[model samples]
Target: MAAQLNHTIVWCSNRSASAKFLTEMLGRPAPTHFGHFDVVELDNGVSLDFADANAQIQPQHYAFLISEADFDAVFSRIKDRGLEYSADPMGSRAGEINHNDGGRGVYFRDPDGHYLEVITRPYGSSG
Candidate 1:
């Protein structure tokens, strides 16, 4: 059997808020409380477990490969929320989306300042 990612812990100042923010942005179901963590599960079966951080939280990058339709829906939500987004990961190109790999892609920050990316095509793959 092929191995797959099960879950990963995301350090955040507020678990609930961070989890809720991610879920809403991705149009996924609301996170559920599990022990001390707030868990958000993606359609691919990988779960992002949000936990409170005792020290300073270092922002991390999370990229999601989604369908064009999903990207449209998610991008609309991002625009409606007035969240700042960029065409590139470094955020140089603001208020724009990139047609990287012939598919739409954008970058934004989560509530915890984690860089969140959504792309309709995987990088380096022909779209």
Candidate 2:
């Protein structure tokens, strides 16, 4: 079998809050408590395990590919929560979504300042 991502630990001050932020922003299921992590499982079988950081937390970026309909729903939630969003990863254009690769996408920061993105299509998928 090919190697694939199993899980990754996201260091934050509060695992519960970070996990809940991810789940709510991405429309994912609530995280389940594990030995040292709040595991947020994706449909692809990969899980994002949230853990408390021992040192400074360097922000990271995470992107998700979803359907157009799901994008609308999730985007609505983003706005309803008054979360700032941008059309680009650098956040040059705020409060706007990108139509890259013929699909919609937006970038926002998690409670821990991790850049989170949702794209309706994969990058370079336009054909």
Candidate 3:
């Protein structure tokens, strides 16, 4: 078996609110309650678990590979929320798409300042 990503742990100041927002934003159901934490599932079977603790929370960058149709739907929702976004992963400016390595991608942030991305192609060109 090949090694693969299993899940990610997200530390949030407002656990419930962050979980709710993320669940709704991802078009998935709210995470199941689990002993002072919640877990949001991804289509790949990996989960994004949330936790609340009394400490400074550093944002993390999580990228999602999506289909064109899904991209359109999610992008529409991003715009509807009036959230700032960038086509570049570095987030140099708003509304910029970096065709780096021949892949089309965009970046945005979640409520807790976690960086998020949607990509239609993988990085680097094979052809």
Candidate 4:
């Protein structure tokens, strides 16, 4: 393996709310019982951990590549939640797709203001 990803720790304002949002959005179950955090496992074997914090957390961008099917599903969820989304992964204005490097993608912010994205093709690939 060449520099495989381990996991991502998300410092959220509310652990329970963030975890619930993530779990429902990703269509996965919430973590069993951790000390003070909840773990969300992805299909790629990577995990996103939610931890409660008091300090103002700086928003970050986290992208996940998904199949066209999963993308459609999640997009529907976004719509159902009436959440504003951007075509660009950078969370620009609504209904904008940044064909950055020429790939299909979209952006939506999580409950904690974390920018999230789902793309079909990998960046810089000759697809």
Candidate 5:
């Protein structure tokens, strides 16, 4: 069987709020509560199971491959909310978006400091 990404747990100080932030950013539907998790389903059928952390939470990176229109929309939302962003993942390039692979990409952090990325093209893909 072909392996596919199923789900991943995103530990957060507030699960529901984190999930809501992601959903809003990606223009996805509101997350649903499930078994101590706030489950956000992506269009690809992968799920982001948001859970509250009992210990210190180490921030993680989550990237989304989206269309040009979606990228524009998400980028606008990020700017509209006055969120700080960077073109590079390490955050060396602030207040900018990268045109890597000939597609636009931006990186921002969630409320819990989890780095979120939205790209119109996958890395290593030809433009």
Candidate 6:
């Protein structure tokens, strides 16, 4: 078989909280404990293993390609929670969503300050 991404370790101050935040944002099931990590599995079989760390963490970016309905539901939750979002990754266009490549996209931050993005389509997929 070809090489595939199985999982990645995410460094966070609190593994459980970070994992739960990601799962909830993506409307996925709750995270499960695996050893010292909190694992959040995606639909594609890849998993994010969140581990607690005492050192300072550098924020990372994670983007999700979802359906329009899923985007709507997630966006609604974002607004309801009063979280700041931006149309662009740099966050200059705050409180807005982008229609990039003819699909909606938004960027927000997780509890550990990781940049999270949700989009209805892949970049350059539409003309």
Error of 5 at 90 (Å): 1.3
Residue runs of model 1 more than 4 Å from their true location after superposition: none
> Which ten contiguous residues of candidate 5 have the minimum total lDDT?
118-127
Candidate 4, residue 50: lDDT: 87
- Candidate 5, which segments miss by more than 4 Å at Cα? none
Q: What is the C-alpha lDDT of each candidate?
A: 0.95, 0.92, 0.79, 0.79, 0.95, 0.93
Best by TM-score: 5
**What are the RMSD figures for all models against the true structure?**
1.3, 1.0, 2.0, 2.2, 1.0, 1.0
Clashing pairs in 6: none
Candidate 5 residues 70-93, lDDT tens each?
998999999999999999998899
Per-prediction tally of clashes: 0, 0, 1, 1, 0, 0
Question: What are the per-residue Cα lDDT tens digits for candidate 4 across 1-127?
Answer: 5797777789999888887887777677766446776888888888888898789989888888877777778888888999888986545557765555556778888888999888877888745
What does candidate 6's lDDT look like per residue over 1-127, in tens digits? 7998999999999998899888888899999999999999988889999999889999999998999999999999899888999999998999889999999999999998999999998999986
Alpha-carbon TM-score of each model against the true structure:
0.95, 0.96, 0.85, 0.85, 0.97, 0.96
> Tens digit of lDDT per residue, candidate 2, span 37-105?
999999899999999999989999989888898999989999999999999988899989999999999
Better of 1 and 2 by lDDT: 1
Worst 10 residues of 4 by lDDT: 89-98
Candidate 3: worst-modelled 10 consecutive residues by lDDT: 96-105
Task: For candidate 3, write residues 1-127 as lDDT tens digits.
Answer: 8998887788888888888877776678878887777888888999888898588888898888777677777788888998888987667768766665566677888778989888877776536
Candidate 4 — which residues are off by over 4 angstroms?
A: 1-3, 98-103
